[model samples]
Structure formats: C-alpha cells, structure tokens
Target: MTNETEVDVIDPVAQIESYTKKDFQLTRLPYDFLYGLRNNKFQYSQMQVVMADKASKEGVKSFKQLYKDYLATYHSDEQMLAVNYTEFDGQPFQLACGSYICHDDIALLNSNGIVEEICNHPVLPCVRLVNIDDNTEKLIIKYRKGYKWREITVDKEILASASKITSLAKYGIAVNSENAKGLVKYLTDIEDLNYNEIEEKNSVSRLGWINNHGFSPYVDGLVFDGEENFRTLFNSVKIKGQIENWIEIIKPIRAEKNICSRIMLAASFASVLVNPCDCLPFFVHLWGGTEAGKTVALMLATSVWADPTMGAYIRTFNSTAVAQELTASFVNSLPLVYDELQILKDKKSFDDMIYKLCEGIGRDRGAKNGGVQKIATWKNCILTSGEFPISSEKSGGGAVNRIIEIDCKDKKIFTNPSELVSEIKQNYGCAGAIFVKWLQQGDNIETVKHLRKDFYKKLVADSDVTDKQAMSASLILTADKLINEIFFNDDILLSVSEMQSILTTRASVDQNRRCYEFINDFVAVNYNKFNPEKDGYNGEIYGTVIEDRIYFIKSKFDAVLQENGFNAKAFLSWAVENKVAFTAEGRSSLTKRICGKVCRCVCVLSVEETAEDQLLNNEDLPFD
Candidate 1:
C-alpha cells in the first residue's frame, strides 16, 4: 500500500496534519474514495493521477452494491453485508440510491466516486441546466462556453448522442465513452429536481402580446423562441442607453418640424396602434436624391424602438420576398423597416414587395411532413427609404391608399446626418417599449383609440383625404401627439395643414393616367431605340418613327409595359381617349408596312406633341 494525501474540496491545504495521522491505504479503494469525495475530504474532478498498476477499469456498480452475492456466499441471511465490503457500514457514505444527488450533499466525485478511482477518470464538469423554455416535450440545456452561456434545445432521447457530446465540449463539460452514460444519468435524474423553482411561462417568437397575458418578449415574463440564428431579432428590442438620454437626443428631432423625421418617428409608434386602432398596415416611403438623408431619417425613426444601425432594427432591401415576410412576422407589432430601396433591382420586385409586406399575413407554406406550416401574420407600419420614389406612375392605383410617398424635399434633410447616426445607435431601444408600456397602463390604450378616431374624422371632413389615406394619417398624427406629450412636453405640434401635403389624392394615383404618363416618359428615354433617324441600325427596334408620329411595335410595347407592372391595353385605351395615341379609322391600333413586313403598331404622338397639348389645356401654364 502507498500513502496519498486527500485534497479537501474547500480548504485544500488546511488538513495536512489530519491526512498524515490517518495512514489511509488502497484496501476498500472504491468505498474510501467515494466516502472521501462525498465528505469533501478530496477533490476528484481536477485530480492528477500519479501512479497506476494492472491498468484500472471502470466499475459500473459500487463494491458494496453486491448484496445478493454476499448473501449467497453465506448459508443464512445476515443484518446487512455478509462480509464487510466498504469502510462505512459496508456502504458508501452520503451516497443515496434515489434518482439524483440530494440537495444537501457536498460532493465532488458524484455517483459513488468508485468509477474515478477504478478507471482513473476525472470528475465530469457537471452541467448547470437552466429551464428557460416551458416545453415539457423537450429539454433545454444552458451551458457555459468559456464565460458566455448558450442554449441548446433538444429532445430528451438525443441528449447523450455523439454529436451532442461533441457539441458540449465547447461548453466545458468533458465527456468520453467511460463517462458518457454517467452524464446522461445525471441529466435525466435531475430533470424534475427543484421543479417549483423553474418559471413555467411559455416561449414566444414574436414581439407583441403572446396571448391575453399581454406580455411582450421585451418585457420578459416570456423567453424569445425565434430561429436559433435570429437572436438579434429579440436582442434588438432592448434598452441600451438610459431612457433619459434617448429622450434628450430625440426631443430636438421632433421639434425641428421636419416632415420625414416626425412622420417616421410616429410611424414607428403607429405599428403598435394598428391592432388597437383597428386599422390596416401601410407604407411610409421617404425618397429623394443622394445625400438627402433618407436613410438617416429612417434610422432616427427606428431608434424610437431599437438600435438604429443597419442589420440591427433596420434591414436592407437585399433579402428575398419570403425572407422579408418572415422578418415582418418576427417584428410583429413593431414597425417593419428597411433602408436603401435601390438594392432591389427592378420596379416589379418593389411593387410585389408593397403588396406582400402590407398584406399582414405570410404565404401559406407546406411542411416537409405534409399539411401546412405555421402561418405567420402581423400588424405593422412598413418604413422604407431610397434614392428614387417607391411608387412610380405605373404603380397600382390600390397601392396609393396603401402607401404614403414623402419626397425628402430638394435639399438635404440633415446637414450633418452622420453625427445624428452616432448618437441614435448608442442611445436607442428606450422609447418603443416604454410607449407600449404607457399604452397598457390603465385607460391609455382607449385614449389612443379615441385620438385616432378624432383625427380620422377631422382629416376626412376638412380636407380631401381618402378613407385609407385618412386612416393611416390619423394613426400617425395620434402617435405624434402621444410621443409629444410623453417626451417633448407639447412642443410645436405638426398641424393637419402641414401633414396634408403627404396624402395623395385619387386623381394623382389614378392607374390609367399614370400609365399614359409612363408611356410618354418611356418614349422620350428610348427615342434612339426607334427608327428613321437611325435607319439600317442593327440595334433591337422598339418602334419606327415616321415624321411627328412614332409607331411603337405592339408586341414590344405590350411586353415592356407588362414587365414594368403596367396595363398596356388599358394604357392604350386611355392614350387614345386623351389624343396621345393616334388610331386609324377609330380602330384601337394601326397596321403599317415597316421593315419590309406588315406589322401592327400603336401609332402615338411624339413627346413634343404630348407636352404642347398639355400646355394648351392649361390656362395658367407657363411657357419656357
């Protein structure tokens, strides 16, 4: 036998004389090791093995656990052990046969300590599981990867798989074949321990009210359960800087009387009011030339609720339509925002985005197993910005009510926008949650409802506001009033007269008239694509110009219009009625022999004739 000093779990060096007095040996090695570890007289997990003989093997059962074999060796049954197998009452001290370790035990080498002594295995770094999500169907393990902790949700059956064991290496829990069964046993044994301490609230994937409970993920009686990679979605809706700092930087923005700044901020708040106010989703588009501060204004609006930096609360137009829908659903009642509309390659894609983002529901997709996947839906205002207008002349007339196009004006909205960007990024995520909390307090939600109604009534009665336009406008104004009262303490309020400039009338958004204007613009830009001037040119011909009349090829004209989401036949009808397109003998189109073939074309007045006609119709028209 050899002498080995046992290290105390707490005071490692304090008990040097006590170990020297004992003269402990290798007999009953399993029992002594287990007892010493359980009693805190030794450290097993971090111990170094200095000596070995005959190659130690792992023991599944304790030496004292062979009770039946001990009795069988003797003729008669005895009080406990027929032969004394362990040091303490023929049993391992402080070792309970219950499902798991007792709460009161101060143990280093768990599970009898026999395995470590026999196999020379270090004690497993026991995992500290946090019951974050309340799903009994699965087990969620929260483990430390160095200093920071991460979560992995897994089914109970797959807890000790090879992949899972490898995944746990980063979590600091070292496991091998000899100790794999021990780790699994430890986890399953403690699954129900301290059951009452675990919070039993369900997890949520969206931002707004989870149920009648009225708890947002931001407020955190609930855990965020978005896709594992989308942790930023939940993290974005958090408070970083103090609320006072947010208010201080944001107050002057409201006071500036800048339409884009004020309206974008209000729109951020208005998304939450969509449910309470019983209104539909709409778009607030801020567009202008370069350096007009469109994206900066978007960031200011986004800061009202979240981090205003790109890819944080604000997304770009680089994502696909399906990805955007998923993002919308995740944001839920929060304002769904995007910057740099120019990332989208074409006009048709933007038009399609308009309908999809405003639809309030995601596409019904099928699951891999069959049936349908969970349908994602939301109520939110969509905020967007770009170098050009969101809605062009060819946009759907219905899209008019669904969107509010604000020109960023001729000059830059902010002379020094980068300074504002730096401030907002650091001092955001304060107001959005507070605004929601303020509304939920007492009769405040009801108050907002009434404000929306009052504004809508006044907007339609006094001004030429369409119902949809009035609805969106009223919500924004009401939001403006709420935030002003909460922060600015009632500064120079944005009046209805000033706000009315943003609403587009039915005449302006009329699809037919827009289509007619689109054709005129198209012809002017592509004049070189037409003929006569460039005869025998090998470039693809769009039309043939004969004197003042340009005959656009019917196929080419229809295809281009359709590609741009315009109704070509409807545009032709309106163009003929307006005398912009010339028809032969009251027919819809004319047949002309061009390029050595009989071809059908829409013979239209040149751009000069169309402009001169418009000048003649207006008495107040100015001549340049």
Candidate 2:
C-alpha cells in the first residue's frame, strides 16, 4: 500500500476514471464531486471511493446511508445532518435542515440543490406561487423592508444559475453557504408531500379570507362548507368579550324612551347584515344643540360593533376624504362611526367627504407598472354626530337626501350616561356578533327588502320626503323593526309614526329650505341696514320693505349668496325658476324705482313664496 502522504498527492479524478474502466457497477459520480473540484480539494475526492467501498463492504442499504457516512467522516460537527420533525395531516415527517420551507409538495430549496426544479428561499416571508394554465409555474417573492412590498417573479429554471443566485443575494438571501447546503439536503429528503395547485382568482378587497358566497372570517355569522381563499391575506386576531354580558348591559339603552338613539344603535347593527338587501348604503347623523347628548348617541351606535373610544370604532372627522375612503375600504362591510363633525371645519373638504363617502366607491388609480390599480369599494353604514345638522347651506340635495338626520330631543337622553358608556366599553362588540347570529338563523333578505319598499312608498305618499331620503328612513325603520322583533322579543317597536315624524321634519329643511331660511335670517339680522328710515344714510334702499314685497338690491343679494357659500348665478336662476325672487325684465338683476330711487334689485314677492315654491322646485331633485 502507498503511504498516506503519497495517497493525498494522487489525482482522485484520474483514479476514479481508472476504476470506471474496471468491472465496477458505479452508474454516476457522487454529488460532492463538483464541490471538491471547485475547492481543489483532492483529499475529499480521495476519500469518496474509500468511504463508498467501506459502506458497500459493511452492507449499506442505500446510497443515502453511504452519503451520510461520507459526510460524518469529512464534514465538521456543525455541518452534520440536523433533522427536525413535524406532522402534517397526521403524517409524520422530518425536516433535515432549517433553510428549507416545504408547504405541501412544493419545496423552496437553496442553491445547493444543483437541480433544475428548485428555487432559492426568499429573503422576506411573503411568497406567491402561481401555477399557470400551461402547466408552467412562476414564483413571485415580495420584499418588504424600508419601502412597500415589491415583487420579483422568476421562472423555475433560473434558480440553478450562479448569476441568478448572486442577484437574489444582492436583494438579500444567503447563497452557496453552509446554510444553503443544509437547506438543499433537507428539501431533497422530504417524503410523500401533497400540494394543491394555486390558481389565480379575483382579489378580495379586505385583508382576510372570504368565500364566494360572502362568508368571511371577519364576519361573525356565516355557515357554509367550502374552502376560503385569502385573496388579500391577513392574520386573524383573538377578540376577547362575552356576548351575553353585552346584551344585558345594552338592554336598558335599547328600551329607553329616546327613540332616535335606540334606532341609531339598532340600525348600525343591522347595517352589516343588510348586504344581501337591494338598497344603497346610507348615513345617519345625530344632530342637536351642544348639550343634547349627540356624542352619546353616536357612542351608543358605535358600541354595537367595537369599542366606543376616540379612535377605535369611533373616529374623529379630522382626516381627509381619501383617508375616509381608505378606512371604509379597510373595514369593508362593517359600520364606520365618525364623531364631532365640527372637527372637519374645512367646508369644502367636509362637503366633498360627504358626497364621496355616499358614492360608495374610491377613485381609480394607476399602478407603478402602468396597469390600473385595484379599485377599493365598500357598502356600509356611516354614523356621524354634530351639534348642528349635516345638511347645511353648502350641501346639495344629493348629500342631504343620503343622510337621515335624527335630532336628539333631550339634553340628557340617558339618566346615567357615564355608566352606560362604561358598560359599553367593557361589553362592546358582542351585540354586533349577536345581531349577526340572529341574522344568520334564517333568510331575512326578502323581508328586509319588502319592508323597506313598503315604508319607502308610505313615506313618499304621506309627506314630501324625497325617494332617496325615504330610502334612508326605510332602512332605519326596517332595522329597528327587525331588531325589536329578534332581539327585544317585540317589547318595543320603532313605529312608522315616529319615523314619519322624524323624516318629514328633517326633509322639510333640505338644501332649498335651508337656503330660504338663510335668506330670512340674513334679512332679519340686517333689517336696520335694509330699512332706509333706521340707518338715515341711504344711496338706494338695498333691501327695502315696500308694502308686503321685500325688495333686495341685486348686488347685496349676490353678496349674501357669496357669504353663505351658495353659487350666486345658480341660486339666482333657481330662485327665478321657483319664483322666490323676480326681476322687472325676467333677468337676474333688474333696474326698478324703489322709494323714489332707481335701483337694480331682485324683488321677493312674499315670505311664504320663498318656502312654498322652493319645496315644489326641489320635489324632483335626485339625492342619490
């Protein structure tokens, strides 16, 4: 036999070639040969045959056993095989390395696999494996570090290239290292894994699992047996509360004499369940004086679904319309509660927000890759509170009609508002779940639709409420009636009479009514200026009281329109069409002799005309 030093000096590749010429049953070289040749390590190559021959003489059962023996002799202790065991579907399995990730049959292996079908593990945890229709697959890895999640999709064949591995490492992942080697070995050894092909489907807007039939993980009441696909994936959180405790605490408030507050809370709960009903999503605003418990009413409504705290379920109106749209999209079918509309002091922003939210869809955008971004959409109720009504001089008929303004009658709707708030704080979110449970017991969609339609027709016939305004009231009525029957055992009913009173009164003061009211109030406040006898110095009587007709100077009338945020030309045209004001020549401004002076003015015929004709003209306005 040659000396050990001389054997180390021998060319292992030449020796292997000579041995292949002999009658040896070796079909191919071992996997370690490429590594040894790259490292210029003749020692590892020299030991391969000795280890294989020794294993064969010792009656090794398989090539894996021989490979293990070779690793034990040459590799260090840290490089030795380390196995971890886990069970999937009640089947025992072992993961021989740490870097490998096997989710079913598809294993993402490291660069050491030296195979065409393997892919390097991504740096980030987010990975999308898509199997196309042509029997080919694509792996897209999104890296979320300092910036937003960015995508890098590649084919399976590119995984074996050194340049591909280097490029991936630049984005961050270890390649050709000890960790990669172990990962390769572990992935290659997994046995009998089952994997289902991932097919592309329509993306859900919310960040949780949902089925095709609208059954969602976030939704409380749903019973269907089908696989849920997480189009916009998110982890579920464990909520802590007892539904029984909540129902008991909320019973008194629900049974209280404040029908507006009770209806607001019930309608908020019913909003989530009304997705199956064919009606547009609408808003409810609790409006009253400073101490009228409007905030408490909004809190009661918010307590149905989540914490009534400042930022939990009840959010401030200090954000932009874009932010509101995003929040609505994030919550999806849940109720969105906004408190203190006074915080949104920007009149234009507030007006835009009201219109955009009632529209029920977000603005379309373009993605970075030049494709149209997924549009965000939601259908849900928006509950708001303010010291004054939501429909103001700046609001149009469309915005006014979409909201049901419930005026809180009393300064204190609850005897102990603090206790009610505390009870709700501890026991919130359960009533919403209970409401959902009751809704899921049977199909109530047709009943809800019928009740809404019937109520809509009744309100339209009984009063001057617009169709959209009547629709909002109808939803509230349906919710209150259903909730009283289901949860309250029909003990208290939010009667159609009460709703009729509230809606008719609220509808009577819509945009035109408010505008007319604003004109009267302005005239009353500036009566001294309009009266030539009171002020003593007058070039032309701006607003002169002549007999019964109140004549307003055209310039002063336009100034009032500008001060009240009404479009001057549009209001003038509207006033002319409605006969609220008229000119001598049927124009906006007309020269007339008022109190012995020629002046350009718009003549208000009577105070009653402003109120009556404005309503008639506003009868066909669309509030959708």
Candidate 3:
C-alpha cells in the first residue's frame, strides 16, 4: 500500500486528469500546482484537479474564491505571454503579456467545474510588455490626442505605484484602481483583443476640425465615419430651413436683369467651388466709396458658406496677421472673407497678409519644446472689401498681381439693402453645399484644371493682363462658365469679355499708377503747406515754382511716404524707372540740397502731363 501510494504521488497526471474531468464541486487549488500551470509546467487538466482537491480539503467556500486564489498564485510571479490587439486604424499589434486575470462582474463560464470572465477595465490601446526576469516586467503604452500619438514606458514598480490608474487616466485612459492587476493580467493572457473597437467609428486627422477625408466640422456635408477601409455616410450639416428658401433669396441676385449682382454672386459661389481644382489662390478686392454697395457685395460672398454677421463668415481687419493665418488654417479650403479693409492699422501688415494669403501657406515657427510646428496651408479664394483698393501706393507688382480689384461703384446694385440683408441672414450656406455636392458627383477636377489653363492662355494671348493676373482671372472665369452652365442651367453666363474688362480695369492701376495717385493726393491735401501764397505758409514757398520742378522738405516727404506704406528709397527708384519723377539734372535722385539743408525734391511734368505719359507708355491705362 505504501509503495502504491508513492507511485500515485510520483505520477499524479492520471489522478489530476481524472479529477479534472469529473463533475465535482471545489473551492481552492494548491499553490505549487497553480503556479506550475501558470508557468506552463503543468497542463490545464492537472491544474483543475489540484484546485478541486485543494478546495475540498481546505473547505474553500465557492468556485469564485477558488478561481481568484488560483489566479493570484499563478500570476504572482510575472510571466511573458503572447498578446494581440487591433488599433483604431484597423492595424494589428502583437506583444508579450506579462500577467492577466478574469474580471469579477463579467462572467464567461458558470458551469459546475469552471467559472471564467474577462477583465473589465480600461487599458492603454497599445502596450509593450517586456520581461526583465521571472519576477519583473516593463510596459510601454501609446497615448493619443487627435492625430498625434506618444509612447510612454514604465516598469512594473512604476505601474504599481500609488494612483497608477489616475496617472493613466490623464493620458486618456479610464481604469479602476482595483482592476489594475486584473487588467495587466488580461492583457498578458489574451492572444487576440480589439483595443479600439467602438460602436461609432471616428478617426483623427492632422488638419484642423477638417479631416483629410474631406469632412469639416463647420461645413455641412457627407462624412465617412468608420475605419478608413470601411465607412458609412453621415449627414453633418443641419439646415435650419428648406432649400427652397435659400434659392428664393438667391433668385433676385441671379436674375439676368442685375448683371453686376449676378456676376458678384456667381464669383462668390465660384470661390467656394474652385478650391478642389489645381489653381493658385487669389484675392477679389471689392472697392468703392461709402454706400456704394461694397459691404453688400461682401455680405453676398460671405453668405455662400456661413452667416454674413460681422463675426461669422466675415472677419475684420482688426486682427493681426498671425490670427488671420490661424483663421485661414481653420477655414481650410473655404473662402475667407475680410470686411472693411480700412480697419487695417498697419499697411505693412496688410501687404504681408495679402502675400501670405495668396501664397497659401503660413510662416515656419518653432514649438515650445524646440520642435518645428506644422505650417498651416490652404487653397481657396480670399474675398475682401473696403472703400479703397487693397493694392496701395507702396504695394509691389507681385502683390498687386495677386488681387483682382472690382469697382463696386453701383450703389443701386441692391434695391433694398436692409431687406436683402435680412433675406441672406435667414437663407445662406445652402448654395455652398449644393456646389460641393455637384463637384463630388464625378471626376470634374481635371476638367476644371484644363479649362482654367485654357482660359489663362487665351487671356494672356488676347489681353495685356500679366501671367499672374491672367491665372487669377482664368480660374474665376472657368468656375463662372462651369457653374452657370451645369449648376444654374446657363442662367448667368460670365463671358470672356466681361472678365477681360475686369482685368483691364485692374491692370490699369499698377503699382506705378498707384504711387502717382498717392503723390497727387498728398499734394492736394497739403497744397497750402507747399504754396507760399497760402495762409498756412509762415515764410517762403515750400516747393519750387519752376516748370516741371517739385521740392519737398526731406522730413515731410519721408513722413508721407512712410504713412502710405512706401520706403522712400525704394519708391524713388521705382519712380525714376517709371519716369513719374526725376531730378533737375534729369538724374534719378531721392534727396537734394535746398536752403543750405538736405531736402527731397523731384522734377516731373504736371499731373496731366504725367497721366498722358502713362497712357502713352501703357496702352492698358484706363484714363485718357
């Protein structure tokens, strides 16, 4: 009997397997046996018998207690196990698990012999488990914010530290402190688990509220919400009224009777639609005197995508260039409208703003952590309005070329401004959506590019419009033609002649012409200061009376130039090259000696003569 008992003890597999297969009630398992099964030294069948026998002998009350104790002892010493999980992007990640356990509330199996459940605890979507030894492990987890992801690594000691769950929650994880051990165990044991499986699928993108998949938080449209490979349509925009109301509001502007209104409204809609095509972004500066319907035109433009309220779709010039850049980035691919250009305090900032907007990219900047920040970029039309043209006396040809200035001198463009404004406030943003939907129907981007190129070449060949201006006009014309024919059923066709006339007017006032205009305006405003016969003059004449001769105090001349956005030296060079101003000796000079002191003076024909000279030199000049 002693020898037989020794044999049974020595080879316990049969007993263990038999007890495991039996339908028996048990409570506890032997520590050594549980540990062996956890470490793969014994099979699961052997573990069952050891646990049942131990529970029976020790009076373990319930299977739950028995299982919990078994797991505790099994996972006491960290052991590496294979784990697999799928990321939010549907990518698979594999790692070694260090420990695992069944959750308390989520029961999986509640049979006579076995009770199992999964750990119900929030865990890092992705974690790296490394075994340092039989008793120690390291874990690396990935934390995500929007499109950016960061990895954090910690040892077992650090993970087990106080408030570990709270620390993890700071990184977008939610886990109960009591379940931390179980979570670690489950992650270590599970061979396959979906880390980011959610009912509603939403992915992160680098672009501001606008996703790379062409979904924008601000614009109403169809969005694909799910994994990139699989997506479902979601209507993102909530319209306040029926689409017919919007059409009713736009009908008056679109009617053939109001050509200016039709052209302006079409251009506004075209601006929003042209973003998808391959073309350079340009500005449409609507300028005229007070009450000339410039603001109404701007409101018309703003109504295409958003409310025309002062702070809604239309931004003001009161903001800094940096703010504008950020706003441009946020609006991505949407027309940016700036109202009342006169509010721009600094001319240089305005010039920089125009160039930056036209360039379609922001300045390179560094982050707080010494890393370079992502540069903001956009492709869309910029609409601006003011009493005066955006291109001023100090603007360069490059800056002037990027803008298509429209003279909104027709104050009667809208019969009742108040009523029209009220209509637009109630009915807007539908046309923009319609335009986007129309574009998404087919592959029309290539067609747009081809048409833009063709129009650009034709404009260059037929008119004196510069290549850049031609490019800008061509995009608008192409969009106008397509929109009139396809979307509006050819209601308001924007002919090449109209585009040519617009470009011709803009081309007439180049940088040189603007400088001359500024000079004339300055002389007019300070005529008394320059004339000896005027009451303002205390003593002698401030300017030369000789024919084709003009003299100004160097200090006063620089002040005027600086106030108008011109660098005196550069403007002098430009003036001399253009024959707008010259020195007495027929030489190019910015400063000369007058009254035993250095002063600035220029010899030029009368304003009338200069206008004639301009017309003779540039046939594109609009003035006689």
lDDT, candidates in the order shown: 0.65, 0.57, 0.57
Per-residue lDDT tens digits of candidate 3, residues 1-624? 123234334444543433431222432223333334433323443444455554465454454345544444433322312211121221233222323333222222222223344333223434434321122344555544445556554544545544454465565544467655544445444423433331112322212124234435333332222222211111212234555686667666666345456656666655654465556678888877888777787787667666776665577888877878876765656677788999976666667877898898899999754689778787777888887878765777678778888786745667777888888788766766666666555676667778888887888775677777777787777767776665556356666677777774444545555666676667666666656544555764355434445666556666777777666666666666656567545544457555456666654434656655565566534332
lDDT by residue (211-323, candidate 2, tens digit) is 33343434433211111222221122113367667667767776676776787876786566446564676888887777777777787777766667665556778877777
Off by over 4 Å in 3: 1-70, 73-252, 256-261, 272-277, 285-319, 338-348, 385-398, 406-443, 457-466, 504-507, 520-543, 553-556, 578-580, 583-593, 596-624
| Cα RMSD for candidates in order | 9.1, 11.2, 11.0
Worst 10 residues of 1 by lDDT: 46-55
Evaluate model 2: give its lDDT: 0.57
Q: Where does candidate 1 stray beyond 4 Å?
A: 1-138, 142-151, 154-202, 415-419, 462-465, 519-557, 569-624
lDDT of each residue in 434-456, candidate 1, tens digit only? 88889889999889999899888
Q: Could you say which candidate leads in lDDT?
A: 1
What's the CA error at residue 25 for candidate 2, in Å? 29
Q: What's the ranking of the predictions by TM-score, best on top? A: 1, 2, 3
Q: Give the distance in Å from residue 178's predicted Cα in candidate 3 to where it truly belongs.
A: 18
Clash number for candidate 1: 0
- The deviation in Å at residue 463 for candidate 2 is 2.5
Which residue pairs of candidate 2 clash? none
